[model samples]
Target: MGAEAILEKIRKNAEEEAAALAKQGEEKAEAAAGKIRADAEAEAAAILGNARQRAEELEKRERLMAGLQIRKNTLAARRAVMDEAFSLAGEQLADLPKERWEALITRLLLEAAETGAEIMEVPAADREKYEWTPEGNLPIIGEKSFFKRLNAALKESGREGKLTLADAPANVTGGFRLMGPVYDVDASFDALLSQAREDWEQEIYRILYPKDE
Candidate 1:
């Protein structure tokens, strides 16, 4: 009811109000801090996930590039092999002679008879040497002289009855083709030399490029 008592009441009410405002400010600050921390964590996780995805994509691209490079190298190697094989065959054929060719054909026929070959086919160029008949029991090639020589050689080797020349001309050069019931023998210079070169190609490459080893 007096002035001092009213002043004390006013001071007490002001103190209580100040305490309540302070508590409210602290609560708001804590809530804001929590929100900031959560936002920071989410941002960090997003950045890490993006970096991981980018790294995986880079690795996949590198692997694909490596596979492509390997396939290209393999194709190049096969092409080199084919080129060398044909080149060597051409070089060998350039210097071969008729006598050598005839002798080789004779030998192939004899060997074929021994191996149970019933029919022997030779190139048209060497047909005359074997004395082949046009329509006899033993077949003859188109060239008469090559057939004569072939027949003579077969008779000399005691394989005339078993050695029958084929009427069809061969597809190859400087070699005879022998056909049996179950197997075929190609004794042509091209085929023989090709096989020899194929067997030696790896060794030759190693010798030529020793650093590759």
Candidate 2:
């Protein structure tokens, strides 16, 4: 009712309104800060999870590559061993004794004689190394005499036995060749060993790398 009292009442009401506004502003600020903090925490967790997943994938890929490299190296080493084994076989066959060499050739000719009329060609090395006859025995053409003997052997095996000799030396290391009209039989030691290597690879592998038994 008094002017002073009315002014004081208005002042108190204004003070209360200002305090309420201040409290509301502080609460809103706190809520916004809490939301920002939660968002930041979630983003950090997501980044950490993604990093861990990428690391695991990279580690798995490295392990697979490492295994593949080891297998590749192992295969290369095994191939080297097989190659050496065949090389040694060729050497041994080439170094057979004279009697054994002749016997082997005779056997090969007998086995390979489809029609024994195929032209027989000797390797340059064989022509040089073969002991065709007894030293100083009788036949002046010792090579010819040896060929006649081969013909006899062929005839005994129920073949044509008329294989003519070739003028040029055969393209071979050891053993002999029989050239027919259609195809030729390569009885060269190198050729025989090459074929044998293919046929015996599995057997050789079994010997080289045995199972648990």
Candidate 3:
């Protein structure tokens, strides 16, 4: 072959090699750019996830604090109500008259007779009103005026023979207790007041926190 023809062939081979190298460089650059973009996207996703978690935690903490505050207010209000009720009851009991006491005892005795009670006990403060005897069939103790009144009332209702009066502890207020052969009834002021509190608990809460609705 001629030297010019050989030189031309060598130049053509070099050109082809240069073209292949250029193509390889372009592919490498594109791969590197794609990897950088993927890494950036992954970092952005992590940041977004962390932000969402922090927001949720803050909301939960706020809700917990709010609940604790509400509970504290409710307890304080309930305590105030109990105090007021006890004070009012004390005032009423302190002002009770002897005639009122006797009437209350009579009513309690009639109720006990209706319930088939055989024996009754009452507060020690009301023993004097029970001196009048009924048919004298039932033994009556006048040591507790409340019990005596109960026995007298029972006797007046033809149940005197069925009921006996006993003196209870002096710690009790104006109310009386009825004890049958089988069961006993606690009709004391404390018991009645306790029932009243139970019955009015919901109403009290409503009055205290009407805005909660």
Candidate 4:
């Protein structure tokens, strides 16, 4: 073949090879771009899912916190009401008539009396208020008051005991302390009511909070 023709054929073959390589390179680049796009979409979907899950968790936590606060408030309100009820009870007892109080004192003394000798400790206020009488119907000591009658009542109630008023007063509100050589009895209103407060709490709650019913 002629040199010119041979050179032209060589140039055409070189051009075709270059074109094929260019097309292959373009196809590889496009495939790489498509893979990158798919990866980015997957990453975005994962991020979105995590954000949604976090939001749901936060909402659930907030709801739980709100519920706990509500319960705490309800308990506080209930406690306040119970405290007021107890305050009213104290007031009512303090407001009792003198006659009723004497009768109550007599009953308490009678209940506390036992065979043999016993001593009664009353509040300082009661000491100034009531008088004491020795054995048998006598003139009396201190003032004309409940303690005088108390001894007679104890004897009549079949308690074979000498009830003597203590020199020192008791630290009590409404009831007295009965002391014997064997054992002592505390009939203070604070003590007796405190012991039964737990047993009575539920009943008091039911009476005050009947909204559930």
The per-model lDDT (C-alpha) reads: 0.71, 0.82, 0.69, 0.78
Worst 10 residues of 4 by lDDT: 134-143
Model 1 agreement with the true structure over 22-63: per-residue lDDT tens digits: 999899899999899999999999999999999999999899
Q: Considering every candidate listed, which one attains the maximal TM-score?
A: 2
Q: Per-residue CA lDDT of candidate 3, range 1-213, in tens?
A: 999999999999999999999999899989999999999999999999999999999999999989989989978877898779666986686467767756765675576565444656556654444543444343454334445555556667776445655645435675767667667778777777787788987787778768876
lDDT by residue for model 4 (162-192), tens: 6888999899886789898788989877766
Q: Tell me the deviation in Å of residue 153 in model 4.
A: 3.9
TM-score, candidate number 3: 0.68
Where does model 3 exceed 4 Å of error?
A: 1-15, 114-117, 124-149, 156-158, 167-174, 207-213
Better by lDDT, candidate 3 or 2 = 2
> How does candidate 4 fare on TM-score?
0.72
Whichever of 1 and 2 has more TM-score, that candidate is 2
lDDT of 2 by residue, 36-100 (tens): 99999999999999999999999999999999999899879888999998888788888888678
Residue 10's lDDT within candidate 3 is 96
lDDT of 2 at 172: 83
- TM-score-best of 1 and 4: 4
TM-score of each: 0.57, 0.77, 0.68, 0.72
Ranking by TM-score: 2, 4, 3, 1
**Each model's RMSD to truth, in Å?**
6.3, 3.5, 5.4, 4.4
Clashing pairs in 4: none
Model 4 shows how many backbone clashes?
0
State the RMSD for candidate 1: 6.3
Worst 10 residues of 2 by lDDT: 127-136
